[model samples]
Target: MHAAGLGKQSLLIPKQPLLLLHGLFGFRELGPFVYFHGITEPLKSLGAKVVATRVHPTDSIANRAAQLQTQLSQVLKQYNTDKVHVIAHSMGGLDARYLINKLDWERNIMSLTTLATPHRGSYIADWSVLNIKQKLKIESLFKVLDIPLLAIDQLTPQYINECFNPEITDVPDVQYKSYGAWKQFESKFSYLYYFGQLLAEREGRNDGLVSMDSARWGQSFNEIPNCDHINIINWSESKFDIMPTYQKILSDLYHLEQQRELKWSIR
Candidate 1:
């Protein structure tokens, strides 16, 4: 699990620092728990300056975006850099998009790489909200608990398709890439396995929650096989090891940085 014996060659010194943004119900560090478990230290060892940001676990994307913008500004200042390459997972991708597009941070972000994010939206969110509305009617209770159902609403197909799609546009200067994970089990024992089957039945291929089609966005896209939503982010409970995938992504970003530098030199 350590990067020292990973056998991967250290990468060239990066031009821009890397910032990791976690997904729904994510935290930077809680005791020994890390949202992006086994990610930051390995990347740092490879000569990439990396930082994982913490945001509201259950707030609306706009609210989280604002918080990320503030945190990113502080990070930029701390590193004495003008821009950063972002690796965002799940809902964090939406927050990053909102920050770049709506918060005027396009120029401050070099590239964005999203992992298993519901770019088009998720049916599960729709189902959850609908079920809650009909059965629990816990809107008031959720508000009192500071649980933002608005965040869940934003992840629904209607919001992403009808509202969010129109409001957000890709910035020309920033490079964008997306990766999706597909759950590959048919076991009823695993809740995520069953959920993946349900989504696959209706949506073709899915990573338990987000469908491959829904997770696809950005200029380039990739599908990672044999992993669920949480697994794609290298969680401890993952069925498969995802450390190599992280290394590959970081390598791609290094290439992107090289390309950008080459273009700048030509100009």
Candidate 2:
């Protein structure tokens, strides 16, 4: 759709609060470098209570999940609500899933909408930790830099297939939705374009980092056209506008919530 056609007036507001969870190396608010730039305010203006959470930027999913759980408790108490709808980007989605499944947070989460998350795995992560020798070297470097490299390990296909998949179970009560994006073409200015090309060559269609197939995990999935990994969250940076896309997502959730309430009333 065209950018001009995407207006906030047409967007529907949901009853539940929205908690925005950022991806790996992401923060809640970093001065001018906010993770999901120009997103929360518009959502709030639409009559939705929006809260962007802060988690350990480079920590493992379990550790980040714990951090999110704590933040979630505070947000729920502040909003006086029992549950919240989550809009998580990239690795944040996996963190939310870990919280819900492994940390007993299923009852506290109403719905989860994942954007370009590596559900199965990312080839980049696989490449990084290709062999035991390489993994050890990378881990040592991260340790020297005082950065958590365990999170990187968790993103690999081997880790997800062997360790994560077995423990993390999807609860039937929680509503799940996922979205993927693909880079249109390569550009010398954009590093994501180069990565996208590399991934497309190696792992089929991908949004720079995460492949479209890897991002598809929830009950419902969507593909956003002409968007790279970073631009999928902030499409205003690219030629495509993401405002309409986000509005549509919120509208869909609003309708879904209405339907859920109606079903409860009917029962």
Candidate 3:
């Protein structure tokens, strides 16, 4: 029922592999999803083809989802297949959720693996706004959108209302899993870096963008430590091993492979 040999590899290059997406204000090239060269290559090593989706990272999650849907439609047509799994980061997960829950695409996807996605919004995004230093930075995109800084106090109920939670979105039929990373901010100049690092240090958890409670929106969660939102890609120039996280991610996908077959048969 899983399109025959969903996980098994053969001559045709297997399924459409994984679709990776970037978060808000994040382009295809700058984030860990893209900057880290080995990110997808390692997944490819698992007999899967990887596709990085490009969308206007600054756009609202709704708009981004619409654009990604268009992109995904083309990709599916190109591969001549209807099912593809997703690995999204930060706000990218929000867009992915919209694709499955809002666009009537529940049946088209096999699994969703979110890394540092703010399922409940970010507390740091709120804390940063109060600081005068944060007001004039490129990372202030969210603050700019809210304007007057204090308008929506980081992950406010209103903010969540606007981003998601309209009409009680149902959890889709496919497998879902998440990972989170966190770190502490020691200084202003190092705000992004340190916060990202804290998100990474998760004594028990991260990719540093979203907290454990915020990231795990699926049936199960794959916990990792010492990696921030972008660190998930790679440590830029640092020689840290990101394979462990990828391994956990692959494990989740493997489970989804089985789950998809079961669900397909049920249908």
The candidate that wins on lDDT is: 1
Q: What's the TM-score of every candidate structure?
A: 0.93, 0.91, 0.73
Candidate 2 matches the true fold with a TM-score of 0.91
- lDDT of every predicted structure (CA atoms): 0.84, 0.82, 0.64
What's model 1's overall lDDT?
Answer: 0.84
Candidate 1 residue lDDT tens string, 1-267: 434434545444466888899887789999988888777887776677888999988788999999987788988998998989999999999999999999999989999999988898898887778787547887778778777767788888889989987998889999889999887766777768766776788778898999999989989999888888888767735446787777777778878878988999999
In model 2, residue pairs whose N, Cα or C atoms come closer than 3 Å (at least 3 residues apart or on different chains), thus clashing, are none
Tell me the tens digit of each residue's lDDT in model 3 across 200-251. Answer: 4532233344677777677777655545566666543335466666655666
Worst 10 residues of 3 by lDDT: 1-10
lDDT of model 3 at residue 87?
Answer: 86
* Residue 184, candidate 3: alpha-carbon lDDT: 46
Segments of candidate 3 deviating more than 4 angstroms? 1-16, 30-33, 128-158, 161-163, 166-168, 183-208, 236-238, 262-267
The candidate that achieves the highest TM-score relative to the unseen native structure: 1
Candidate 3, number of clashes: 18
